[model samples]
Target: MMAGAQRSQTSFHFCHNPHAGSLLQGLQELRSDNLLTDVILCVSGKEIPCHRSVLAACSEYFRAMFCNGLRESKDYKVTIHEVSPDALQLIVDYAYTSEITITEDNAWQLLEGANFFQILPVRDACVTFVSNNFSAKDCLQMMQVGNMLSCPDLEKNASLCALKEFTTVSKTPEFLSLTKDQLITLISSDDLNASEKTVYRAVMTWINHDTRKRKKEMRELMELVRFPFMDKLYFLENVDNNNAVRKSCQDILTETRRYQLFPEEVESPCTRPRRTSGLREAVLVFGGLEKMEIGENPAVFSNSITCSPEPSTSSWTRVSRMKRKNDSRFAVAVLGTRNVIVSCGAKSRDVWLYHPELNSWHKLAQMKENRYHHKLAVVQGKVYAIGGRNLSSESSPWTSVEVYDRIQNKWTESVSLPKSRCGHAVAVVDGNIYVMGGLDTEYKDTSTVYRFSPGDSQWQSQTDMPLTTYAITASVLNGNIYVATLTNFLCYKPCENGGSWSVVVGVGTLCMYGMTVLWWESSHLWWL
Candidate 1:
């Protein structure tokens, strides 16, 4: 009866022995005992003896072939195609001992071998090794290898490297060797760093590489060049001087001329200049502390730095210092990728815009209100400076909202918040403005949430956050709002019956100053 009762419980505590799990135990004996390897793999005139069951278990390709009744299942000798024997041997060794060494020479071929056999772990490992060591110099070859093997992630990474370093990349032999289609795809990208004239120069170089052979394809390739984006001087000097423009390239050059002469005549369209943004995948963090210098607030702006997606390889290098001083009452926003505006609240009553790439500053019109603790957010290119407190007293909260028209260089008053609040968080999610958590007029902490749409004159109340606080950081991911408080992380699903905040468990964390939140492509929150 006791045994039956114990069996009915259906749960057991199982123990594992350390010796049995250790690779140090009896490996020499197992090496000697060699259970008579059932298969031989042939590659590059070399034969590697391996167990068919082990290889089949380690690879999906072999698994389906051996277990699903395929032709290769009964064969004792299998010939590996395309991959060199050294790489194949490494892959086979990994199958038996779960270990393999990847070197610079063998990394690419080893990855090809792993992918051919459908061994994801080794392939992923190779992908990491290749990409972490990637640079503009080797990116072309890496891109070719990745594309040939159909490894999309590696292909994208290599392309990003190439695009970011295009000026140097275009000078390489590989770029010159690219097929017409490949070159067109490259120059057609909006992210290319080179100017349209530079791209035109590159195209000319390619055409002149084997002019007689490539001339037939020149007109088709010329269409990919955005000639209107070229400087008027460069267009006259380069494009007008080219013999191809007078000959077969006449149609494309004519279209560009028409577009530039009459931009309103949209019969032919031309590409406009794009904002300069570094690193296709990255996070921009803005934060500054109020450092008192002998009872004075000096302008203290830190150097601008960018980090790569991989945190370990990144460092913050100072670019430029701030042009002015402020202890508080500061609000910041990004105006496209071209401008970063850092404005201070009342008493200072001024605005400054900085270009990160050029390290240049531009002074702009002042804001109407001068409240410190205000929050600034850019929604669809318009800067919205939200509620804040009076400079004289922290207790006096401002209910007013100011919208900055970047084109006009002026700020106009908009409908105020539902209540006078300060130190609140504002985020733009799916074209709607979501404002959450702040101290009310009485200087008491509250978790009140409000939202405003584009045409709405007044803010609408939403689900209150779980924590009561004057400060919170918000970001949007996968079409949901993620709000992190001083102590907890919460997510709000707008698609749900009535917006509600649900706790997301077990994402490790430490506190970040300024409470800046950004959505990472990896579906995790990046704090700055």
Candidate 2:
């Protein structure tokens, strides 16, 4: 019985044949000698003898045509249309031997044939060949071909190449051949990597290429130029005075003028700064008390605004100073246009907008409530001021929340917080507001976390923090909220385990009280 049981576990092992690599070679030799050739593929009046089994084994197109009980299955000859003879010959050779040489003169035809034949390996090889040979002069052509062949990788790479070398790509003849919609899509991309002036010039060049036909597209195309972000002198000299722009695009020109004259009043696509123009990722530190001198008062507040270009830079440049010297505990948030909004925390309703390009501060509409130690968050193009204590009111910790309306130039009340708290850390992820650890109305630290969505009447309570700590700072990175407390750095993943908190690193020794954490340059967290 034991022997029979052991026999039941016995199995035969099969090893790979060492000579299997020569099978394809032998098939190629058979095709060379025209031995047992069962099919002939005809392309452009040229015929090539091939094996039905080999073609069927290598190509889905051939398998579907020959093995699906179609009329072509019993036929000895098949005619392929819209494919060049040379491309067909190469594809047939590759099907048998798994190899083909692609040259510049033959790449497009080979890609088209491979795509038509549903041969993925050959199609991928052709895509790689074209991508490796991409240049500024022909990248637009490559992009068009990739689009035609439905090759996403090739199309994306070619598009990126054109954007990175936009100045040179715009000079190519292929650029002039782009359709009106294609031109608009290209210029509207924030990743164009060219100044607004260069984009404007490229539009003009395209217009002039076929002025009789494309001249009518001036208004539609000019809307994508972002004239407010362009150089002021260049806009006035080259764009404003140009006859075509002056004549047909007076309304757009008027909007551009309004943007230039009153930037805060205008919030349009033309006013948003592109990365190539002047928008950059930098660490900005707002109002806080400076380091105390030997004999200076510790209560002295600092109004200087400074920024570090990157995390690696050790030096910080003083870009601008706040208009009010006594501003402290101010809640700051960056607008969608990359402008910094500073709401005074010195028991005043005054708010200021810091324009990075002008290196100046402009006063914005005041808040509805006089509160200090409040938190600010920008969600969905609107700024929300969260909980803080009002000095004059007997109800010290106010639960009211207000949102700043750019169009109305005023602050209106939104949904209030669940609990009245100040010195809380706020961060926005996926258009939702997250309020972290802070001191409650009873002046005791609370570990409760609350999430609020716009247009919702109530804030949803989230998982409690690991520890109850106040004066914490929080920032969102990679869709996770990272909170820095006096003792440790914690991270909260909203999508993990129904939203949970975990300690990321121990920073108790850093004593990070009253510091703000910011995620800059899409990497590296700076505490200030």
Candidate 3:
């Protein structure tokens, strides 16, 4: 009876078999021989306790085995508190002795727990799970999240998925808001069908059309829409004379015809005259009295200077001290090739033409008479100096006018003013010079405005200005003449067929000087 009882206890202790018991006893005998072993296992939250027996049964494996499938791993500082009781027991048993037999079915659950715990090896296992299960539907939200987090790999994967379905995705308003250039790349590449490309362009045009958010941007969009048609016209005229080509060109012109004013109304309170050649950036204005002082220690003198844009003020930087000193008046205009011609008042007999690019001055042929406070303008590529005075005697102002032909580099006599006037203002609008309010025959202020056409050599009557303003400034903006009245400013919109002037919005009150009202194409201003 004692022998039988011992056998039963040994069988239960070894668990699997009597030979397994004998082998375990033999392994135990070798324990004192400094033996080493390792084991790894993965199990579900409920299977942890069962893993404890396996770990104890294979004690030799515990010597060097590393277990990563636990919800809490000893590698990082993070401790897992929400582990199941059974899983916790399994983890503890594995920690005490690294022996376990985790089955494949339970491997995924443990891998998920390991991922949550951020155990790198186990987290890697979960990524493998994803790679094995990747699908088109799974990529949408994943890519969005990846992009939001700046995850480069995930963004690429998501973009690939979106591109796969590009042909099928309808061009909704939401889709239109996507980056147009990116969509265009997809369209132009052979990756999409011809129909898809056509649809995309149509949708893009619809989305970008008729937008007036900025006047400049609107103009650009209109140009973009017209380019294809323009190309067709050019191709027809040069490459082919076929009836189809001619018909196509005619149709395009009809579709894209733009009715522009002969004198384009450049939007402004601009301080410079309209360019004869249509271009955007302003030609720099130089040569004027910028400063004046009244003491002898520094030698008091009046000098005019330039002020440019605020940052580095690149447009026009002012220079100090006039080359010659005198009581001065001036008329400034931009002529051919971006050169500015400045005819000074009676201050000097020398005609100073300023070259902005060179930052220097040059003397031109002298005017026929010494005229100051006269109105000067560029008309049809010619400079006309009108109605100024000679201080040679106190006798007073002159109404004589002279036209300087820039192309010929010679002065031609033109029809003189209706009367002798000084301190008057002149601005060229739509090829006609409008000479307005000045000190008239009696040296008192006058409100009369006269229009001169060099083409006809004739003077016509016009409505008087609202006020008598001398030493005022005038500019043209958006095709309308903006007159800087002495204390205020007014707008003049030329009639389409030529009759009268109409008022535009009144600008704010004046800040006066011997100001030249220039249409600073960039800012559109009337300046002091």
Candidate 4:
């Protein structure tokens, strides 16, 4: 008796359940033969025969209607609103077979029906299909559908696609069909990825598409552009000379003129540079020591500068040189105003601002302490100079930190680092400053990482890096910090598992000291 009871407890299990598919097939065949289906779905004057139990098992909509004591629970025929007949048929087939084909023509209709029927798998699949196949032609329509369906991921992807291809998308009739608020929202983004001239042309095109209806929206639309960043010739010929622009945007034009004439004095959105303007991503080589010959002889520190709009082609153009000669190892950062700020790295207290449009440099108030081999980072529009050594204190690095004051044109003392170090790398992510691997107070390479919030009085220590090396460089992309060390490339995720480090790639023979790494679009790193 005991052996029989034990044998009965040992039950067989089937992970694949070979009969499940056949069971569904049999149910589908029965419904096809009009044998056992108890419910009929009516849509657009057409009827779809389905089993109530099968429908209820797959869809919360049908389950609630049939099992929640609703009137439809007792009825054999139910009318489905909003969903078309073809869409209803597809949904019923999916409920029985657990699979359905999604084509370009039927994707939208299926998505709407699935959303209405609370069929999450089908809805998610439709969203994925639309997002993966998004193009400039259908991005606007997808964005509208996403918004109506309350799918944020789909909406965000579509918006990004439209922005990336704005030059081509703006010429489409769909762009003209956008409402005023929608147009404003699209044009106001800094990530539009189009030149100011192109944006201005697109705005003009939209207004001209319907002159009487959109003429009153001209000023509001034009205000979204960064006019000061436009080319002087384009502004004169296309904008200043346009009678319509003159009539609707006189005050904006005057402000733009002031911004052009006296840029340092003007402080407005018009003066702020767009990401697609002259301030677009480019490789800027600052003043550094360059060898005159190929041999390992003494090199001379020069104030010359160079830039490359596209680094992959290796095409470099000489830009305006720095005013101060023999300036090397300085910290360079782009400010919120889109101007490059260079702090002297040659044991001097001088700071300079470079204007890309004018191709000129202007002097700013100097720092109180001299710094070299330090790092500069911009956080929330303020510049912070991190640790480095000075000539007077050659034995020890400076622990003092300074924040640049643009208004006063001077540097003010801020919270200092816990330990003095030099040759460190600094990066900003989500408004917080991250200082990574550098030499510590012992003048030894350390992998310690420190984080500082502007509102905090002191810096907090996070997870250390994998490699311990100085003369490192770091940059932020997509909310993560990428560090380039002498021998390896590393990525630090601050929000993951209380700050974790991962090795992205090994530098191997490509390793070098005093290198700077910048992250741009196209997933390419510009190394200098």
Cα lDDT of model 4 overall? 0.83
Q: Write down the TM-score for model 2.
A: 0.63
> What clash pairs does model 4 have?
none
Model 2 lDDT, full chain set: 0.83
How close is every model to the real structure, measured as TM-score?
A: 0.52, 0.63, 0.45, 0.56
By TM-score rank, best first, the candidates go 2, 4, 1, 3
Better of 2 and 4 by TM-score: 2
Compared with the true structure, what per-residue lDDT tens digits does model 3 show for residues 1-528?
675674434334434567655655555444334244222233332322222233433333222222445532232222234444444444444333333334444444444444333334433444444434444455444444445545455455555554555444434333444444544444333233324224424444444553343223322222222222223454345423434323434443333222111111121112122232243343233344434545653322354446543323455656543455644676666664346677766546556676655667777777888777786777756788888787665747777889886445667678888877888888877778888888876788877788887677677767777777777667766566777765666766565344455455565665324334334424456354
Q: Kindly indicate the candidate among 2 and 3 with the higher lDDT.
A: 2
How many backbone overlaps does candidate 2 show?
Answer: 0
Per-candidate clashes, comma-separated: 3, 0, 27, 0
lDDT of 1 by residue, 241-321 (tens): 788766987877776776566432222223334323232434544445434345565555443434344343466545555
Off by over 4 Å in 2: 1-9, 17-20, 208-216, 242-251, 258-267, 282-330, 335-387, 391-528
**Top candidate by TM-score:** 2
